[model samples]
Target: MTNKLTVKIWRGKEQGDFVSYEVPRLASQTVLDVVTYVQRNLEPSLGYRFACRVGMCGSCAMTVNGVARWTCRTHVSKVVGEGQLEIAPLANLPVVKDLVTDMSEFFDKWARAKGSFKGKRTRADDFEPVKPDSRERKAADAGVECIGCGVCYASCDVVSSRPDYLGPAALNRAWTLVNDVRDTQQRERLRAVAGDAGCHACHTQGSCTVHCPKQISPTAGIAGLKRVVGRAAVRGRL
Candidate 1:
């Protein structure tokens, strides 16, 4: 793969155009590798975000060829066609620079979803015994490895349409705590995730689930929240 790969990347904000760059192709290189090459060798002005470079951080996500992917893990061979690649910022977010996007809206939704754990116990108190095999712990464990990247948020169609929507990642985080027997904010959390702008807004399209680099199904977890909230509301507990 020594041929020069033609890379088309979106420059600036929504008002910018796609600029082309002929990046030298290498065997077994990832999409991030190409971006790094261009930044280090071809264009130092190019902007993008990356940290672990090993797919764990999820900071290197970009629209590779048209799909949201962790560039650190996406292989060039998997996405390239005729030595050409179209790279762009993650969808559903304001592009700050080339491949970088502002994540404020995405994180704000976490607050809106009441995703934080509100515990009643202090550090001085004895450790809370949680059964690993218990239903609550099992459900919480199902989607606890989220890295807080905006990939799922960017991949969601409902989020693109509704800025007020809580989106999948935040709702999934709420679900993890929703089933936690130790969390004291259960009722309030349920209320936060109820109604049109919360869990009910999810179309269940599964784009968030499909694009999640951590393999966490936020859609499934959000659905669980919806059911829990619906049941509680019916019981007059919400």
Candidate 2:
């Protein structure tokens, strides 16, 4: 293989185009490495975001070859097609510049879903014991490992067409809180996530689950929310 790779990186704001650059191809080359090389060598003005070059921090997520992924974990050899690569900001969000998308809307939807835990306990209250083996705890634990990465949000088509739709991450977060036994806002949260702009909007195509670097099933979480909402409506609690 030649020691050079042609990478088309998106530049500028919402109204930008992909600017191609030739980067060195090395062993164990990652997409992040290519971007870094371009930023350090080819272009000094390029913009992107990355932290914790390992897979733990999802700040490196971007559209690689039309698929949302963590650039830190994506190897050049695996995703490069025809000796070329296309890197852009995550989809379904406003691009601030180049590969950096404005995540304010994504987090706003999380707040709209009432993803925060609202409990009756105060700092002086005794620690609430939650058995890991219990069904409720298990359900809450299923979706709690989210890193707030925008990959799932960008992969969701519902968010693309309907900007008001709470994306997968927000709904998954709400599902976790809904299952929290110690939370006092279950009824209100269920109502918040029940309408067309919430869990009801998910088409269940499983794209979020497929592209999640953490192997999380936001689809499962959304489905659980649906069931919980249905039960609440039946019980006149919604």
TM-score for candidate 1: 0.97
Position 162, candidate 1: lDDT: 96
lDDT (C-alpha, whole model) for all candidates: 0.91, 0.93
lDDT of 1 at 180: 87
Model 2 C-alpha lDDT per residue in residues 1-238, reported as the tens digit of each score:
4588999999999998999999878999999999999999989899999999999989999999999999999999999999899999999999999999999999999999998998998999998988889898898888899999999999998888999999999999999998888999987899999988989899999999999999999999999998989888899988
Give all TM-scores, in the order shown.
0.97, 0.98
The true-versus-predicted C-alpha distance at residue 45 of model 1, in Å, is 1.0
Error of 1 at 128 (Å): 0.3
Write the residue-wise lDDT of candidate 1 on 110-211 in tens digits: 998888888889999998989999999999999999988888998899988998898998999999998889999888889999968999999999999998
lDDT score at residue 206, model 2, on the 0-100 scale: 97
State which candidate has the highest lDDT.
2
CA lDDT, candidate 2, residue 129: 88
Q: Stretches of candidate 1 above 4 Å error? A: none
Model 2: residue 76 alpha-carbon error in angstroms: 0.6
